[model samples]
Target: MLKHSDIWRAIDRLAHRHGLSASGLAKRGGLDPTTFNKSKRMTPDGKLRWPSTESIAKVLEATGSSFTDFVAMTGEEGDGTGGGAGMSAAAMRRVPVIGYAQAGNDGYFDDAGYPAGNGWDELEFPHVADDHAYALEVSGDSMEPVYRDGDIIIVSPAASVRRGDRVVVRTRDGEVMAKQLARQTANRLELVSLNRSHPDRSLPMADVAWIARIMWASQ
Candidate 1:
């Protein structure tokens, strides 16, 4: 009988074949860059967490592989080449992808375009506006208890980041991070870190790359 670990191992092999780590494979698939990160493969309690079919399909597409190839990769003998019951390779392929550091930023990304970087991991996500997808990496413990270092944040580029919404933004100097938007107006943006250890920060609109509202995190 097939096991969850078996499927995980197959995905690991697929990543290795592409000269990438498991996390890298997820990036290639347009999922959250941390989707395949070892830290995320298990729960905080230390139990294994299986990759969703949506994530698998996304990985296949990002790597330019087919459903049949994925099935072969899974090593599930006699299981038809079509995707399993959870997700279809075709549907997962169509979702947008983004890099971790690039999440939450706005102007820097375009719906019809891709972020500039090779470091990313894949994730399964619902279909959204072409312009509304991206990812970001946790830089500090500012969002602690909720988001930690190395956590990947998925943001919807098209979604409006309102006050209290966790958003990603980059300064003109390229300091990118995820913070809750406390206030926004024509002139400035005020942000509060989820972690009380870090003080709130504010910046002018001109200093930002682009801001996107965060939708989910791999925590």
Candidate 2:
């Protein structure tokens, strides 16, 4: 059976493969731009809203994908969670997400900064090779101007961090902050705050618990 979420995930994967948003895919298919949007995937009363066959046909034509191709993407198995359902090799990924404040707490992450316990809400996003990639939902305006409150920022612990790149850094004192790397050395790290209203941070490397590069953020 094709689960509703699986079909939507397939549509999202299809759009991603073609470098388009779901709305962009719909517009290319001659449908309303919001046809495949996440909001349209469910009704206001929280009812499932499956995509119409005609819309699927139009999208297939727009992207030059066969019905078989679409079905393959759908996986026809389950939600892309357990048993690797709705998988297209690595086109769909489910990552853990928790609030920024919660992430600062212990037990959520291991010493290496990888997701540790099951205290996260899973969210499906575009293909990401890093299995340790997770997202932190911003809680306050401290990271404003660049990442506002409620923004979900994708962080990759496996991704390399460099100077001038935005990163999520945790301190030995259990403080979590998102800032740009001004400098990093064997003994110290210099960070520039995203919001100029906040002061820049310079910390000894020993005081740094772990740091992961911010890969993407929901706008």
Candidate 3:
């Protein structure tokens, strides 16, 4: 039988595995920063406060984790690889990785934004269910604080992007940049840089070749 503590321990382990504190994990999951705080884990009267299923689901989605991974972290009978044991094999996919500098090069990607020929490296990660999923390696300090040098970001062309979503935008001029979507109109787009030192950018939508939403990052 699994105890409540076992579940809590699994959550803590999951957070640590992602190099995040409880509050950091909560924020990444789109929850209130205090959602996983120690105070929230117990009532003032000392009664245990269980995590909500919705919150767990959100965290799993944010972390690209399957139910099997969660169970493995619970010290279950299976190997603790967090490999999504109970999930389908298709859940694991090889994504092409490219440096930020190469991303702006022409002929590297097809018209649909899929990687084309050679000169590409690959990484295996949990599939985000997008065939156009790819990875971009951060190379400079332009996107620091949010994304450091050497961090790999997973981008999904098929993923729906909205205001506030981090996105990789390629322009017709061969400029590729990662920025937060500040505003989007049918004719124009406004982007906010991650680094405070950089100024916001605005571009005509017609100047963009493609824009993909960033799903996750391997910090």
Q: TM-score of every model?
A: 0.56, 0.63, 0.61
Models ranked on TM-score: 2, 3, 1
TM-score of 1: 0.56
**Best-first order by lDDT:** 2, 3, 1
Question: Candidate 3: TM-score?
Answer: 0.61
Residue range 143-185, candidate 3, lDDT tens digits: 9889976567888988888999999999999899899999999
lDDT of 1 by residue, 1-219 (tens): 757777886786566445454665665676776787757779999998988989988888876777666556666432233335434444432233444445445544444334544344544443445443655545545678887555556666667567789877766666777788999989999998778787788899888666767777754
Cα deviation at 195, candidate 3, in Å, is 0.7
Estimate the lDDT of model 2.
Answer: 0.80
Note the Cα lDDT for every prediction shown.
0.64, 0.80, 0.78
Candidate 1, residue 33: how far the Cα is off, in Å: 12
Q: Which of 2 and 3 is ahead in lDDT?
A: 2
